[model samples]
Target: MIEIRNLKKSFGSNLVWEDVSFSIEQGETVAIIGRSGCGKSVLVKHLNALMYPDSGEVIIDGRNVFDLEYISLRKMRQRFGVLFQGSALFDSLNTFENIAFPLRYFTELNEEEISDKVMEALELVNLAGTSEKSPAELSGGMRRRVALARATILQPDFLIYDEPTSGLDPKTSEEINQLIISMAKNLNITSIVVTHDIHSVLKIATKVAFLEDQGLHWYGTVEELRDSDNEELMSFVSASEYQIRN
Candidate 1:
């Protein structure tokens, strides 16, 4: 389980969010949603200790991640797989090399082991046989898949997606959403997605965390979100096609 207790963060004199608290159960997919600059990305960064909160704690499994030593924190971070918003692929490297980057850096695995694991990850993302292709050679959706394969090459326990479907068309976005669902169900990995797309949220999230007003305004299941009467949440939803009944 991942527990975020009373977390707060700020930049200079500007407050991003504060006193946020939430817990993500193992094998659950949670979507963090809010308008732009509500600190959705910042909150996810805190999850992996990529950034630290000014106050409070993030307890992953049992240990507070913020309190871990550098070495221990490095090891802890290996448990996470992050798919960045822009795919963040190395244009110079082929897909295979991209996926193998982590294996080479983090493990003592030889060439044969790296090859096998890279292929396995490629297959997991339905991108097998594209290993020789560069990021420039693939479509936007395919590039995202390649990035996903690379992110999961180490077989991490948690998957964090930052705007996974941001630039894709509706059909492609749906495909990515399905892949997110598959990653959680097939791998039993905890999935945390930061997105502004309500359609993607409906397709992928088991739980929803709403960041607003310098705090977590709401945390509940997708079903509860559909039925919620909260003004802020409803106002946000209204901007999308999801209408809440009074």
Candidate 2:
């Protein structure tokens, strides 16, 4: 389980958010949603210690990640996999090598073992035959799948997706959403997704966390979100739908 306690952050005199608290149970898919620049990405960055809060505790399995030493922190980070917003794949590497990079760097696995793992990951993302293809050869959605394959190759306990469907058309967005759901169920991985897409949130999230007004404005299950009468949340949802339709 991951527990976030009294999280606070600021840059110079600009306060991002404070008094944020929430717990993510194992196997839960939590969507962190808010308007652009509301600090959703910053909040998820705290989970893996990529970013730190001015004051707060991010406890994973009873250990405060903020207090860990360098070696310990590095080990903790290896348990996470991140699918960046831009599908940060290495253009120089083929699909196979891209996914195998982590295993080569982190583990003592031989070439055969690495190949097998990479193949499994590609198959998981339905990209089994494109191992020799470069990132540039893949379409936007396919590149995202390759990125996802690389992210999960190490079988991380937690998966963080930053705007997983940002530039995709509706069909591709739905495909990515379904892939997120599949990864969660198949790997039993805890997921934290930072996105502005409300429709994707409804399709993939088990729980929702809304960051607004410099705080975690509301949080609850997806069902609760749909039934919520909270004015700000309703407005945000309506606005998102309007944008989607236009």
Candidate 3:
């Protein structure tokens, strides 16, 4: 289980959020939603210790990640796999090499083992034949899938998706959503998704965390979110859906 305790952060004099707290049970897919610049990405970054809070504790399996030494922190971070917003694939590397990069760098796996692992990851993403293709040759959605393959190749305990559905058409977005669900269920991984796509949230999230007004404004199950009576949250949801429609 992951527990976030009264987290706080600031940039110079600009306070981003304060007193934010929540817990993510194992195998849960939690979606963090908020308007742009509301610090949703910032909050998820704290989970892997990519960003430190001004005050608070991010405890994973009873250990405070913030207090870990460098080696310990690196090991902790390896337990996480991140699908960056832009996919962040290296254009210089082909798909096979991109997916194999982590295994080569982090593990002692030989070339044959690396090839077998990369092939498995490609099959998982349903892109088994595109291993030789460069990122530049793949469409936006395919690029995202390749990125997802790379992210999950190590079978990390946690997966962080930063705007997974951004810049995709509706059909592609739905595919990505299903992939997210499949990853969580098949790997029993804890997932944290930062997105503004309310429809995508509804389709994939088991729980919702809403950030606003400099704090975690609300949090609950997907059912609770749909039935929520909070005026601000409802307004935000409605507005987001409207944007999707028009």
Q: Which stretches of candidate 2 lie over 4 Å from their true place?
A: none
What TM-score does candidate 3 reach?
Answer: 0.99
Instruction: Give all TM-scores, in the order shown.
Output: 0.96, 0.98, 0.99
Local accuracy of candidate 1 as per-residue lDDT tens digits, 1-246: 899999999999999999999999999999999989999999999999999989999998799999999899999999999998789999999999999998999999999999999989888888889999989999999999988988888888999999999878888888889999998998889999998788888888999999989999999999999999999998997775552222
Give the alpha-carbon lDDT of every model: 0.91, 0.94, 0.95
How would you order the candidates by lDDT, starting with the best?
3, 2, 1
Model 2: lowest-lDDT 10 consecutive positions: 146-155
In model 2, the clashing pairs are: none
List runs of model 1 lying over 4 Å from the truth.
Answer: 242-246
How many angstroms is residue 35 displaced in model 1 relative to the true structure, after the best TM-score fit? 0.4
Clash pairs for candidate 3: none
**For candidate 1, what is the total of clashing residue pairs?**
0
Between candidates 1 and 2, the one scoring higher on lDDT is 2
How many residue pairs of model 3 clash at the backbone? 0
